[model samples]
Target: MQLISTLATIGFVLPLFLALVGVLLARRDYGVAAAWGGGVMMALLVALAIRGVLRGDPDLPHFPSGHVTLAVAFYGGLLAIYLRGGLNRDRTAVPVILATLAAIALLEGVSRILLTEHTWVDVLGGFAVGSLGLLATGCPWAVRRIRAGSRLWLAATLAVATPIAFMTVGWLDGLIRHWVTL
Candidate 1:
């Protein structure tokens, strides 16, 4: 459960990265890609605002589990993208995949509570925010046919750049740690 929660922690960039990369990998339309990005941004922004108003945990905002938000939006929107775009021609497997995604989301949310990371209300709030953001854009744009043709280069660049970015971050952290210790 701990590992599952940690993996699903969208932490701002993960969902955005996943949305863009998933769209590129799927060869989805620009509109669909935009919708995916918008949906995620809207959910996170709204969740953050709600957390601000509600006043919970000064140390960290946990009113809406970002773990659950991006987990659902990223995967749910991926499913929507596949279903809407007809990426997967086999209609039969869609339901099974949806169920599996839902189950994983459910398990993740439950784990958050079991681990005392969030209350039930927090989890429910996350579910609502994620779903509402996805629905607000509607399926047409979410499934748009306007293709963003620059597939290989952008994704390939990210694939190469991501490791370098991580290495740089790691090096920076080590330097910062040494300076602090001094």
Candidate 2:
């Protein structure tokens, strides 16, 4: 019980605080990206909520945190964008991103080991899926537009759709989990 409480507290505090920092940093140069990140996070939360409703999981509100994944993803994307500038060609950017990702994974792993959550796999899976979305959204065309500051519309779309995507994923997971039990 103490472990769960500690892990939960760590899960909530670290990710939430980092996300705020990420938003502020992104907003300094990429307001749209920051806003988009917010939108995506919100949508994901809603979707998770819906899934809990369908699954009749009374502890839906107490479910594992997806915001951690969001925090990692959002910051990861921003880092990728920043590195694209090639300010340090001799330096590696991927490693930095990977390290950040690994840190998040470690957090989740600790959470699971502490029994604060169900499994490390779920958090890792969320991290992978979230990163894929971040990569996809940071493609050449997307990167160019974001850098050029001409893709406000595209950023807005991402802001709106990412969360919806997360919600849908949560809903499907809930359905499948319930189905499997039967």
Candidate 3:
């Protein structure tokens, strides 16, 4: 349980750092960053709504795991995008990174289930939500425009939005931690 929790924590924290790095070092386009951020935001809202509706109580919602949702949406999405040549030049980098991320996500999902933090269904839901997020930003159709100054604006917006979104989710989860606990 502890091992799983640690892995889960790492998986959760990794994306925030990666997002920062991608934005600052990799010079990821702002629109892409916005897509990722937007996906995360969407997942949170959807999860919260599902929890409220199914659980029949806004104060004690359930069904989807927010942690898993964010992990899959942000980390999984980032990994998927990166593997597609978003940031690396080395040919060998993709496989290694993919394997490592896959392991982390798989482990996190399994642990969450075993620990009763979430059901398998919830985890799957998280994965689906995350995939949607990835698609939202990664799909070619979604990023057809490359206007000048767009990157700067998007990056600046994400620079502010990323941390704020992370903190907001953290605060929200903290508020409902007890109620949502498995």
Query: What C-alpha lDDT do the candidate models reach, one value each?
Result: 0.64, 0.46, 0.59
Off by over 4 Å in 2: 1-43, 46-51, 58-64, 92-97, 112-115, 132-136, 139-141, 145-182
* Model 3: colliding residue pairs: none
Segments of candidate 1 deviating more than 4 angstroms? 11-28, 56-61, 87-89, 137-139, 145-182
Q: Pick the candidate with the highest lDDT.
A: 1
Better of 1 and 2 by lDDT: 1
The clash numbers for all candidates, in the given order, read: 0, 1, 0
**Model 2 accuracy (lDDT, Cα):** 0.46
Q: Could you tell me every candidate's TM-score relative to the true structure?
A: 0.68, 0.45, 0.64
- Shift in Å, residue 168, candidate 1: 12
Q: Candidate 3's residue-wise lDDT over 132-180, tens digit each?
A: 6656656664353433444454357456755655555445445556564
Q: Tens digits of per-residue lDDT for model 1 on 1-182? A: 88567545543335346545565556646566677678777886787687777665674467777767766776576556555544444568768878976776788789899999888887987888888667754556455533434333444645564455444544554564465321
Candidate 2 local lDDT, 1-182, one digit each (tens) = 43222322323333333444354355453543544454444434543654455466554433334533454455455555545444444467557655864565456545553665545544554455455546554644434323433224334544564454444544554564475431
Error of 2 at 173 (Å): 26
